[model samples]
Target: MLYIQLTPFPELHTERFVLRRLQQADAPALLDQRSDPRIMRYLDREPDTTLEQTTALIERITQNAADNSGVTWGIVRPAATQELLGTIGLWRIMAEHHRAEVGYGLHPDYWQQGVMSEALAAVLDFGFQTLKLHSVEANVNPHNTASRRLLEKHGFVQEAYFRQNYFFRGQFLDSIIYSLLTPEAAKPELINEAATEL
Candidate 1:
């Protein structure tokens, strides 16, 4: 079985952004994204219409980290104000199986800008290297071509497609599953290059 520890809440940094813990202060920004129809369209959950809802969501994310069941990061640009541009996480952890599910959403303003790709690369590194996960999976709305493309760009392959497997908002929805497995070994040059990038 895999062992996991999320204490101290790992804060990851890439060239352009910082992946840090979500806080109550971030509720408003998060609400803006969660309440936007464009951002929430592919997500099954209802739009968060109130600050209270977003705050509760942050609280749950905190609890999940404390419980070591999951970890979520608010993606923030380092050079700019410390407002969240998006959010990402590894959840639905199956420690015995050394696997977890990846989920994310960005404010529409930040879309198509490679912001999520950077965040995802950092998270995947943490999931595989620090958490020792053997594989990571993503379940996406079938119509979310952008998400599918993003996962594929990160080396995730389509593992399965379930037709009308999800019931949401009075409709049955199809889901596409994508996955990436930890490589058996890292090439020396690749390892050194990754070391420098981080």
Candidate 2:
């Protein structure tokens, strides 16, 4: 079994952004992202319509980290502002299998900027190097082409497609599963190349 420790709350940094712990003060920014239809369209979850709901979501994310079940980071451009531009995380961790699922969303304003690419690379490194995870997977809405491209660009390959497997908002939705395993010694330049391209 894999040993996990989230007590210190890992904070990751890249050239342009910082992935830090989500805090109560981030509720407003988080609400903006979660409520925006463009960002939440493929997320399946209902838009967070109020601060109370956003706050509750933050609490849950915090608890998940506290329990060592997951870790989420508020993506912030520290050089310009402390406001959150998006959120990303590794959740549903399966310690015994040394795996976890990756999830993320960015504000529409930051779209197409490669911000997520950099953030994701940092997180992937942490998962494989620090956490000793063997693999990481992502579940994406089939219609979310941008997300699909992002995962693919980061070395993830499509492993499965489930038809109408997720029920949400009175309709069934299809999902695509993408997965990436730790790079072998011979192929040492996996995520690093992707990160540098951004």
Candidate 3:
């Protein structure tokens, strides 16, 4: 059977995380976590986001899902943790090339808990084994050491550092390109063990 037929677009659930489709009602939860400057400062946002914008963002994500171009999974703790931990997405899908760009962000409170890394391992596995993507790339602002560290921990190599690639806030910011080949991305068990030493 074709890989797509086997698992083209199934929901991904992990031990502690539920990777579900985003809905409009999710906006308020997203706003609650991301509206804070601490969470959005390094993000590529307008810095001022209202509930309306968050609602619209969810709509946009749903549209992408409809078009089959990409989808955003809202990461939630199934234990009724009552917090939107973060999001994991396979955006900028290039079906012809069998590749996609991966992006993620988390509530600052969830940092250092290994939640994002654990979630990333699941997504990377989904990308390679399920979606049959040949590679996955993630871009992060160079100044965001925490993000850089997370990507590196997941077997992603720093491919390039583009100067003044993104305009966040008032100034041009450098962006770091990180990528993991399908074979490399598949070795999450190893990646997780390695992450322990970092």
Select the stronger candidate by lDDT from 1 and 3: 1
- Over 4 Å off in model 1, which ranges? 185-198
Across 1-198, the per-residue lDDT of candidate 1 in tens digits comes to 988999989999999999999989999999999999999889987899999999999999999999999999999988764688999999678899999999999998899999999999999999999999989999999889999999999999999999999999898999999999887435678778888999
Which has the higher TM-score value, candidate number 2 or candidate number 3?
2
Clashes of 2: 0
Q: How far out, in Å, is residue 66 in model 2?
A: 1.3
**CA lDDT for candidate 1:** 0.92
lDDT of 2 by residue, 74-189 (tens): 99988855788888999778999999999998999899999999999999999999999999999999999999999999999999999999999899999999999987532748
Candidate 3, 54-158: lDDT as tens digits = 888888887777777777788888875445678889867778778789988788888899888888999899888878888889988777888889888988999
Which ranges of candidate 3 are over 4 A from the true structure?
A: 1-9, 184-198
**Model 2 vs. true fold: TM:** 0.91
Worst 10 residues of 1 by lDDT: 182-191
- For model 2, name the residue pairs that clash: none
Clashes of each: 0, 0, 0
